[model samples]
Target chain A: MAKKAVQKAATPARRASDAGRAARIEGGAVVVTGICGRLGRRLARQLHRERPVIGLDRREFVGKPKDIEHHSIDVRRKKARELFRRPDIAALIHLGVMHDPRLGAEEHHTWNVIAFQKLLEYVERYQIPKLVLLSSANVYGPRPDNPQFISEDAPLLGANRFSDIRDLIELDMLAQSFFWRNPGTETVILRPAHILGTVQNAPSNYLRLKVVPTLLGFDPMMQVVHQDDVVRAVRLALRPGVRGIFNIAGPPPVALSRAVKLLGRPTLPIPHAVARAGVERLWRWHMTSFPAPELDFIRYVCMVDDRRAREVLGYGPKFDLGSTLRAVDEERWV
Target chain B: MPARTALARIGDVAADDVLPFMGRLWGGARRSVDELAVRVLGSDFEERARLLQARYAEAGGDPFGLDLETAKYAVMTCAFFHRLWFRAEVRGLENVPQGRVLLIANHSGQIPIDGAMIGTSLFLDLEPPRVIRAMVEKWSQTLPFVSTFFSRVGQVVGVPENARRLLEMGEALLVFPEGTRGISKPFTQRYQLQEFGTGFMRLAIETNTPIVPVAVVGAEEQYVNLGNLKWAARALRMPVFPVIPQVFVPFGQMPLPTKYLIHFGEPLHVQGDADEDDAVMEEKVHLVKQTIQSMINRGLKQRTSLFF
Candidate 1:
């Protein structure tokens, strides 16, 4: 509020040329997109105490902290451009990539890709020193022949079976190109494994089901990171000199059955063919959120090797396997 | 209403009393079977299983989904074939070195019973009981129970990365470099070494792992593969379609109980660039292949009978 007040009080000429330059003299604020998300909110709460944080999201940040600045505006809107013009954003952490499979392709594409393109342009123009995009390990699709541990250099093949993941892959590719084209910005792309926490992701929601459905006779090894661990990884990426693609895995890989057992859920195991057709029908009826293609995850190995994240980013998962699996149950009523 | 009440009462009785009674009965039966298995296989089997569990404790049992509990039963089942069915004579048991090593073996038998026998021999015969992790064909991973069974029994997908990771973890890896060609060879081509792939040699050199040439003498006689039906194999999306008349016979689905002789040659240390020219790597691979062939020949010469 004080910063905005000062800008308003300044003369137009002084603010036009010198306002951005002078504000950058102090350590710049970190702009966090999708701050309204559960993971993003957790990250904001952790980061705001140390440095200034500006939240950018279309939705309101409920129970927002006093010090953090919240902007309830669409990322592609002109008002969001006004925030970038301040030139005080030292880093931009993109966590706003929409991945709702139910959303129409046009809206999904516009929000995830087009909005990201606008943000990249701002970062390039403003010369933001750091850019971190929260990509996912799902970009490397589950395959029958995938090596047990996939490295960072693996191709983005998540869209082969599940077309819903196309936007996320596009965003990751866009960030990669941005990293190459703009060398000045320390662009970091984090590809964390299936995150199991209060965050409303597919893995978490699936585990939260009253009777978790699984493919019979298919128990692929899975790696699930905790939400807090992912938040920590994002914070580490925000650190200067930390730049590259890092796969964040929480703990040692466990079988899908083992994970379900850890959650203590009674599972309804269906054969792959029957489950696929059933899920397709249920999805069409809006009775189930899981698309049929997503069943491949439970059927094949899509785990990643987090050696790069551990060696370079110095990030380790503090949550053990048991707690990580149980996190989906936290704050369930909310 | 009277019929509905009677059915609901029967359901309630089944859920409340009959289920628990049945569960207890099943539990008792399973316990007796376990005891019978232990008595038949001897207490040494359980001891070896415990030792293996300790060995894999670091990875919390296994990263590749190797449930030692499931694997021990598999090993126990194979132990029967190794001990009684084929009565495999394992030679040069001490030749296997501790720590990460590659067992380059000849792949034979219409099925992979030879690999299972090798694994069983290593587990039952070798001191400290090393579990051999072999690489299964990637296509097998597409099969339902086969894939799960392979994973539980410590067989991984045949990928370079999986092989490298296994070696790095200081586990013994079994590589049948001949792949489908050697395993599905026609009866006329028996005893002749099929073209070995250079992948195992490259992996051995890259990981600085010692290569142990393993020779199984009697597997070729277990099931006589007349020829490979290429058209059928392609149509079925199978690696190879070996035409074995035994498969058509009433009891011939089971491999003939041919007396087996396995020879483990001394570990060979091959050092070179992993990415060296194929010709250079082939020389090293050829050296290993020739050693295996000679060992197989010697074992064949020493064996007195095919089904003794």
Candidate 2:
């Protein structure tokens, strides 16, 4: 039998427009690992509005949320090549890994650092155009007389155990970003101060125990970023060519005492050192026995200067510390 | 007793009254002082005698005992900015307490010359001069003249222990709550308040001291951060990328002589007894921070031009 001649036909104008729209969607498609988590969900929802979103989590999605497509896969166990077989992933927001604050240094190194390294290698091998990695302000250790404003250039002293973990992760991210940038792939790192907002199904986890208590007139002071701001920054990062680490924090910083006052709650002002010691003791006794370390979530003084975000990423916080707390108290998300 | 009496009587004798009579009797200078020297030791020796007489007269002209070494050093250091005409217009100096007040200002510029200028203004302009001990960063202690001079002038490292020690001693202390971060922030984020560390509050509460918030304008524009060299920072173990600026180039690595206005706000008194409740103390600290930030915002707003 003779081979059938396949004539190359020009796409119709209407079809061309459809293809163009499809191409844009494909270009903006983002693969978010760990979309089941609070932060991951928020990011997924935010990014889905602008692009096609594929959420990969270890747990299967019985029914997917609006606009988000889901896949069941453990990032640690699966190979990236096998996982991203579709080849149309324009960006990857790696939000996976067991971020258990209760984990020890060794466990954290294995789960966060070691797993992150493997992910970076995958990102590089796949030649992903953009990667947005979320970091925390914990990289900058606590100091009593720390400057009221911490810029990106502020010292990364990694004083405590948790800070050390964050510091290692930040270094890995930076190294990865540099590696990709050198090869023409763009990477954006966001060091959000303290993530605050609501999530469903999950227990009142890090935000409730660590952040909410402090904001409600506890002894500690913390800088916060609203969920909206965090999501918005991530969305902006999805646009091609945005690179560099930006500190995404709220407007200024509020004392836990002040936040409590605003919340119409009575505050107890124990000495910072005493409070920290108590929390550390509690973690040692019970919290760390879990898969994740609880004390890692309780750090109260993680602050950073978000000048770079304001200047470069065009990021301004929609909610300050006061508003963020009010939303939480009202259970806005739930 | 007799020797004491004789010494007292001699002290009472006027040297001026004795000098005229003694000069006439010693009128060998009437033996033509120059002529006598020339005849006794030849013409060459006369020139030497003339030089000696001129030196003796110059030494006798001002007999006040002034330690020239210390005076010279002071003048030299004071003249650091002498090459550039400094036009400092300080406002709200009255807000500064006369004795033992804590001066809290934002830290900026590569080197904290604003603190030095404020100290100098206090000593020179205020009556009954007061000394200022700035609570500086520990890293500053490594710099050559800065560490020694700061030590000599009673500048303490801004550690909690040092701050407590200074407050307990009833000395005026200057603290920049923003520390290195405030001064070193990229030029893009100017005049924004950083997260005020709690040390100032803890110190104030512990010592029951009042804080005088200071707003310094015109310092931010002094040395703009044109760019940051990240690789160099990593290589050198430096915290931030080294800032490149127009002022820090070629000869005389000095910041531009930007006009400075140090505005002082009213003192914030942490009320209640020394043993006030912790919540009350924290409230006071927050109020003070807000007050200072308000003052700074106002000052920045009121300025006609950073250039002027």
Candidate 3:
């Protein structure tokens, strides 16, 4: 599937008085954390068209600084004043944090939640008008019998450390957004399911050993969102009045078995107990020293109800599961 | 409701009421039959005779008085020929009112024999025989043999307009919100409820009719898909492979006669008053679907004997 640009068509300029008010302001700048990541790079590029985007990351992208400004900063280090010295930073997109489950509970708690708390404080200190936070669908846990697609109103069971941290971050974001009670400085928390798309020179969480090796023949019934959809959702979140958590996933849930079949790769169904034991052995051997919490987390299927994304945000994916799987198989990057 | 007339009440009694007194007469009659045929028939002749009598009662055939001759003939021919021997257990039968109510059950199985069995139970066991008008898919209307029988039995064609029309006339209508997708799910996805369309809720709200939740087990295990022919299905405009079960043909694509259990949960009363909120009604409908699915899962867990 061809990736459609997330940039909305330009509308007529504001009236003379409004234009004059806008002109009085200096350069409008947006701060994007983890801009070196797959989704972060797309968001930076899209936002840079209208505003000067500052890409903040601990690592560097291949061809990033050629057009946009890149800043190396760790969000957890309380370098708020140093990072916010750029006078034109009007909005903040918090995408930085450790997503690897190999990181233990304490590390994840400190990086994902504690760092987010500090970042939220820094955003408020800098008085950024808008904030877009990325969340995950892991909060819903597994519900095999729930054919209703696990709506937002469904009970959440965060059985692992990663999801528990995610839940806390979401709670904090919601609390602060409603604290000042200013709808103008809105906050959009997007809970996206497993995202599958091309990432140059980087191993994706989805493409890791646990899921990839598990994909023998038939795809497990899991939901995956394309990278472009994530970028589109971020752009939509930048628009005014798009608040609250939106479950963004592909058009329909794709089975992992079906996805492997689409890739024309054979899949072997390893029993859940056997898979768990294998991961434990890998951890003991220190072949990859990431914490096994995420493996434990993936054991519980993650599926979300995308009704709100369709009904409210006017956001829907261009491709269904079949097409998305084909694109992933072909390694097409947008 | 007033008491039935004395003659009518007496006629409503089962023929088995006089079995003890007439046992010797029937026993002698059976002995006069050919010895070879009797030996081949085995020892369940009495049970078979009782089943025929029940089927006759189901078809509105009375075994007493002047109607006995016609009833006996019907039993000897059609009833015996259509004899369906399968174990069935019904739950929440007490919640079904004797009036015109809307019955909504999950749809599965290629021919939807579950619907026929439920109709049989209602006609035979209910205090007053009730006719269950079910909404069948438009595709079924194009199939040979099925379309005519459905129409003859007063089944409504499953279109939005037809459904509303049936509800307008205050007829008991059965509909499967999952439609064709529910039935076509492979054995791997059996017993899991598919996404239910909101048409039933909309119709219930529009007509202010009560929606009774129903769950049927044993239908899914009847047909297990060994493999799906995707190209063939696409050419035929079908979504799944035609299933081949172990019972029907041993190795061919035919369905097995698995024992069935149909459980009807309590009726969710959609308020008839015009002032009922739409959101509240939708929530109630969702709760009803959830309740029925839970009941189904619970019943399935309790069923230890699937082979019988």
Best by DockQ: 1
For each candidate, what's the DockQ?
0.53, 0.02, 0.02
lDDT of 1 at B79: 81
DockQ of prediction 3 = 0.02
lDDT of 3 by residue, A1-334 (tens): 0011111111234244334323422246778888888778877777777778887787776567466888677776656556775556666777775555555667777767766777677766765656777766666654322222455545445453445345345543453454345333456667777676664311233443333555122122457777778788877776654556678887554445445666666655654556657767887888654444454333333567676877767788877665665545444443
- Displacement of the residue B50 alpha carbon in candidate 1, Å: 1.1
Q: All candidates' TM-scores?
A: 0.90, 0.48, 0.52
CA-lDDT, candidates in order:
0.88, 0.60, 0.60
Candidate with the larger DockQ of 1 and 3: 1
**Candidates in descending TM-score order:** 1, 3, 2
TM-score of chain A of each: 0.91, 0.76, 0.76
Predictions: Cα RMSD each: 8.5, 26.4, 22.0
Q: Report lDDT (Cα) of residue B189, candidate 3.
A: 78
**Cand. 1: chain B TM-score:** 0.86
| lDDT at position B288, candidate 2 | 71
Off by over 4 Å in 3: A1-27, A76-79, A82-87, A144-147, A153-155, A160-184, A199-220, A288-301, A327-334, B1-84, B87-269, B272-308
